[model samples]
Target chain A: MPYVNIKVTKENGGLTKEEKLTLIKGVTNLLAETLNKNPASTVVVIDEIDMDNYGLGAEQISDRRKAGK
Target chain B: MPYVNIKVTKENGGLTKEEKLTLIKGVTNLLAETLNKNPASTVVVIDEIDMDNYGLGAEQISDRRKAGK
Candidate 1:
């Protein structure tokens, strides 16, 4: 089984349950269609991290947002 | 930046903060040393999913656990 994990920043109230379910189903379908993996056995996990906890390009997302870049 | 998301089952008590940090640091170091990616630019997100929400081998982890196989 393949476990897919999606990470998104907890900004703008984060994703609703419907959005998460959509991602889960969409990703499951993609894997099943391309990799031939069984959709019934695939798992999808979504993580909503705080901007301060996620960094990229030597700066945190929170800082990047503050800079408006 | 490379974002690494790890998924684990929340069967017992969830991972301790120390365990999470260890994983984050270890994975970051591995990526930095192997792929030459900047450690500061890497993001590691850990997700602990409920057994009912995670499936493998066409069965939910909760079910598998209950089966004791």
Candidate 2:
């Protein structure tokens, strides 16, 4: 039941909303101190993508097209 | 850049080595399909945790204690 999902590239800003909830509570306290467990069952999910909606295969994309896609 | 990380109880046992790979690919594909992005750019990470090694608060531990924790 350990979950961590991070999808970045929404301009890759430093982060705001309280530093994205303090980076999901500092990555759930670093996975409960690297596997000691029980930081409220550890569940973190962060997804933010922009770069013209994201890409990579048809051409190196993402990174929000350098702010001009 | 979009990434997905799913961590489940290792004892869940609904997947094998190849199935794990398939799960990753499937998740990636789902993300690409849902977001209409390049499959290569979407990274998916799945971490498995054992119940004995993972806990929920101070009790009600993970789904791993049924074996005699």
Candidate 3:
């Protein structure tokens, strides 16, 4: 029931509408504390991209280098 | 980049080893088509959960419901 679909990038230029509702309430509190679930049946979807359209295995990266790049 | 995290009800018996990978690929294709991005640049995440653990707007539901219900 917890639906979280987050595709990040956009060179950090996106996420403006209240930071996309605070990133779907911070990924619904990190998937309700890592899977315990119950943050009102968390359903978070944040898809934003631009940085070369995003990649990893083939090279390109974002989300700040997939949290590291 | 495209990183999709899908959390569905475990009630579906949860996807198996190959199913998870297939899902990621499916979502990647969807995002690529919808957003006009390269498939290689897409990163998808699928998180499965119990039905009772997810809710939408104070009402519990599943992907089936979210899609229409």
Candidate 4:
């Protein structure tokens, strides 16, 4: 089983259930179609992270958004 | 920057804040130490998932636990 984890900023009150389901299905399908992994066994977990808790290029995504750069 | 995502069953009421912090720190340190990645730029997101949503070996973890195998 291939465990896939997706991380996204908890913006806009986080993702809706439909978005989460779509993601789960899409990732499962892609892995199954490309990697030959069994879709029934593939697991996908989505994480809604606080912008402050996530950093990229040594700066938090929130800060980047604030700076508008 | 390396982004590490961790997924665990939402058992035992999920992990405590301290546990999540420890996991984030530990994974960040490991990646920095071994991969030469900047700890300041590394991101770690831990997802506590429902057992029913996670599958392994073509079976849900919850089912496995119930079967006591």
Candidate 5:
């Protein structure tokens, strides 16, 4: 089984269910095409994190965005 | 930076925020102890999926659970 996890910053109110579905389909198809993995056994999970909870370069993502860096 | 994703069935109404936090901290510490990764930049996310969406042996988890197998 091929398990894929996607972590995305929760920006702009995060993604809609339709968008998440699109991502799931696209990633599954990509693994099938590239790795010959069976889509039937492929698992894709998406995680949306609040910017405040995400850190980069020892600073929170919210601070980074605020600094425009 | 190391990113970790945990997938669990949405059983018993899923995990509480405190449980998730414990998992995140435990995983971060594990990575640091075993892999020399920095907990500061580590990211951990948890995804809870409906049993109906998860399949095994070409059978949906919901169905398998219903069969008591």
Candidate 6:
């Protein structure tokens, strides 16, 4: 079984349910096509993190957003 | 920098905020101790999946739970 986790910052109120489903399906299919993995046993989890919890370049995402950079 | 994604089943109403915080801290510390990683740049994401979305041994977690297994 292949487990995949996709983490995206919670921007614009996060992703919609349909978008999440699309990501799960697309990732599973890609793994099967490229790595010869079994789609039935593949697991894809999407994590929507708050901007305050995510950091980049020694700065929190929330702060970056506030600065518009 | 190290990125860690933790996947856990959303059972019994999922984990409390304190528990999640503990996991983030513990994982970060473990990485720092074992791999000399920088905790300040480490990213840890926790995913709580629904039983219905998780599968094992060709059976969904929801089904296994219903069967009391």
TM-score of each: 0.55, 0.50, 0.47, 0.55, 0.55, 0.57
lDDT, candidates in the order shown = 0.80, 0.60, 0.63, 0.79, 0.78, 0.81
Misplaced by over 4 Å in model 5 are B1-6, B15-69
Clashing pairs in 3: A41-B55, A54-B1, A54-B41, A65-A69
Candidate 3 vs 4: which has more TM-score: 4
Q: What is residue A67's positional error in candidate 4, in angstroms?
A: 19
**4 against 5, candidate with superior DockQ:** 4
Better of 1 and 2 by DockQ: 2
DockQ of candidate 5 relative to the true structure? 0.11
Steric clash count of candidate 4? 0
User: How much is the lDDT of residue B49 in candidate 2?
Assistant: 63
TM-score of candidate 5 against the unseen true structure: 0.55
Tens digits of lDDT, candidate 3, B1-69: 566767767754666777666556655655564445568756676766676676656766665466665
Worst 10 residues of 5 chain A by lDDT: A16-25
lDDT digits (tens) for residues B1-69 of candidate 1: 688777889878777655666677788888888999988778876667899999999999999999994
Q: Is the docking of candidate 6 incorrect, acceptable, medium or high quality?
A: incorrect
- Interface root mean square deviation of every model, in Å? 4.3, 9.1, 8.3, 4.4, 5.1, 4.9
What digit string (tens of lDDT, one per residue) describes model 2 on residues A8-66? Answer: 65654634686568657665654455444467766777777665565665554553365
Q: Which residue pairs does candidate 6 place in steric collision?
A: none
Global CA lDDT computed for model 5: 0.78
Best by lDDT: 6
Candidate 2 clashing pairs, residues 3+ apart or interchain: A51-A64
Ranking by lDDT: 6, 1, 4, 5, 3, 2
Q: Which candidate should be chosen as best, given DockQ against the real structure?
A: 2
* Candidate order by decreasing DockQ: 2, 3, 1, 4, 5, 6
Model 2 chain B — which ten-residue stretch has the worst lDDT? B60-69
Q: lDDT (0-100) at residue B11 of candidate 4?
A: 87
Query: What's the CA RMSD of model 2 in angstroms?
Result: 8.8
| Candidate 5 lDDT by residue in tens digits, A1-69 | 687767778899887655666676788788878998897887766678899999989999999999997
